[model samples]
Target: MSLFLIAGIALTGFLAAGLGTMVGLGGGVFVVPILAVVLGVELKAAIAASAVCVVLNSLRGSSVYLQRGLVNVKLAMVLQVSTAVAAIVGGLIVIFAPVQILKLLFAATLALTIGVMIARPNGGKRVKSGPDPYGLRASFDRPDDRGPAEYVPQHVRSGIGLSSVAGLTSGMLGIGGGAVQVPIMNTVMAVPLRAAVATSTFMVGITATVSALIYAGAGLVDVAVTVPAMAGIVVGAQMGGQLGSHVPVKMLRTLLIAVLLGLTIAMAADGLGFL
Candidate 1:
């Protein structure tokens, strides 16, 4: 690649990483769009690159969270398996899907993100919290040093079921599972929001790995486009994620939603050959 191209991709990765860090997200959301627009790559190619980027970014952040005792390892592992399986299936669908369909899905996902953010649902009844029946129970250290406590999920079955859906979304949409997982775990499973976010990052790497392997085996993985983008996103995301807090998150989120809507309409038009 030319020097300019290399720098451009690096910039993208940098932004992704920075922003991801700011928002406690893995930052994969920005990768595909950046690759598509900047490198002029096809959607599938961009998605694949974004998937691999997520894997690496997760690994990077996971170790830190693990050290801090933030990751709920056992809980994350169980979810990972379900999420990975779902993602593998989703990734294949993306490979064959029309751009218009993918765009609509992206827009819809962003809309979902916005809705959840606005709701910030915290009040809910825990169906079963004291006695864990689902064998899929665990614990972790909270950031505030509130003393270590074991977590018995009230929505154990539903959590797994939603994970399956999140996995599918991740694969098809080239997103980290956290976008959906974090909210559900917090609102339904009663997992604390920060812990949920951290654990979701832990699981995202696994989901991305599964789908990436499948894509690689199918000869659809394009390192030429992916590597530079990853380099840029990983670096940029950390900063962006940190910056996420300083700004009004709702405003930023709404802006992102608007972009998502425009992209969706554009893609729909493209599919209808109206653009």
Candidate 2:
């Protein structure tokens, strides 16, 4: 590609990653569509490039969340096991799945994500007193200095089931799995939205790492496309992590819903051969 074209791609990657990180979607939601539809890249190639960006965004974003003590390490670790295994299966399926079908799946997933965000726009604020019997306790300091908050995760089994689905989508679509994970963690598991985002960021790195390896081994990844995109994603993820820490939960939810709605429309159009 020409220097100017490369620069434009990098800029797009930066914007995608920034938005994805802020909303905990990991940028693949934007990156894959732009690459495949706008840039005219092949679907598999676009997915591989998006997977690399997802990994970079997750690493940078998760580190920031960890430092703030927003991540639930134990819960993340438990969830990663399911996500990682399912991601490998998803990667294998993508090798043979039709591009049109994948596009439809992406659209459907985004639509579901929008519904989940709308249903639970606010992070659940009611905290049960006393220690959790399941030992899924997590604590984080509030941005407004209202003192630290603590909550126990409920519905562990359901969370794991959702994580597996998230992993499959992440591997097949090159998303970070946060779109599914964050809502489930917040709405079903009773974790706060920020905490859910943080935990999802951490787990998605592991999920994407497994899928990226599969794509790399199959020679699906285009290094020329992935490298610059990753460079931009790293910077954007840092900026997003910082910004997310300060933004209100309601605003973040609104941003996520809006983005998902837009992506849903684009993916559906593309799947129906209208784009």
Candidate 3:
């Protein structure tokens, strides 16, 4: 592409990475839409590029969260197992399944999630004061808190089940699964939103790495497009990570809800051939 086009793509990556890291969406959600719709790139190529950006964005963002003790490594590892396996299943299903139908289903799922989240906006931050059976409990200091907040991850089996679905969608859609993972971790699993976001940041890196490899193997990755975008994502992720560490939890929650709403609309439109 031309230098001007390269510059524009890098700028897009910067903005996407910043927001994605802040809300734990791994940047793929924004990058895919911008690349495919606004920039007029082919859909598969855009997804491939987005997968690469998310990998780098998550890695960089996770490092910051880890340093601040916000990431729940144990919980992330446990969920990764399910997501990783389901991604392969999703890849295989693409051969026989109609993508439009899948999109509609995914959109419906997001809509339902949004309703649940709105109805129970404060449900995920509860800290259980008893023994933890799953050993997935963790604690972290919030930006606005006077002390650390402790929370045990509940409903792990259910979280695993949902994560598998997230991974399947990730594979089928060629995007990182962080959007679904964040809500499931926070809402269904009773993880604190900050920790859930941090953990999701870490988790998406591994999942995106797997996805990027698949795209690379398929010759869908465009190095020329990826290099510039990755450079921007790297810097933006650092900025986002720093901001995330200090941002108020209420603002973060609001932003996450808005993002889900937007994604719901986008997926529904795509399913209906309106986008």
lDDT, each prediction: 0.72, 0.81, 0.74
lDDT of 2 by residue, 125-166 (tens): 547566576677878999999998888888788888888999
Off by over 4 Å in 2: 22-24, 117-134, 239-263
Give residue 222's lDDT in candidate 3 (0 to 100). Answer: 86
- From the highest lDDT down, the ranking of the candidates is 2, 3, 1
After superposing candidate 1, which stretches have Cα over 4 Å from the reference?
37-39, 123-129, 135-137, 241-251, 261-264
Estimate, for each residue in 1-275, the C-alpha lDDT of model 3 and write its tens digit: 78887887788788777766675556666666566556766556666777787777677668889999999999989999988887766654433456566567656766765675566555465766766787877889878867988888888889988998778767655667766787898888888887888898788778777767776776878887788778777777778867877877568768767877887888788878998
How far out, in Å, is residue 239 in model 3?
A: 4.7
**Residue 72 CA error for candidate 2 (Å)?**
1.2
Indicate the TM-score of model 3.
0.77
lDDT of 1 by residue, 1-275 (tens): 57786677677667656755554555566666655644656777777878888888788878888887777787887677788889978988887777767766765665676566566678334333467665655566655778765666567778888899889988887778687888878887887666677788888888888888877877777887788877777657656755666887666666655654555455445545575
Model 2 residue-pair collision total: 0
Hey, what RMSD does candidate 2 come out at? 3.0
Number of backbone-clashing residue pairs for each candidate, in the order shown: 30, 0, 0
Which segments of model 3 are wrong by more than 4 Å?
Answer: 19-25, 92-120, 142-145, 238-275
Give the Cα RMSD of candidate 3.
4.1
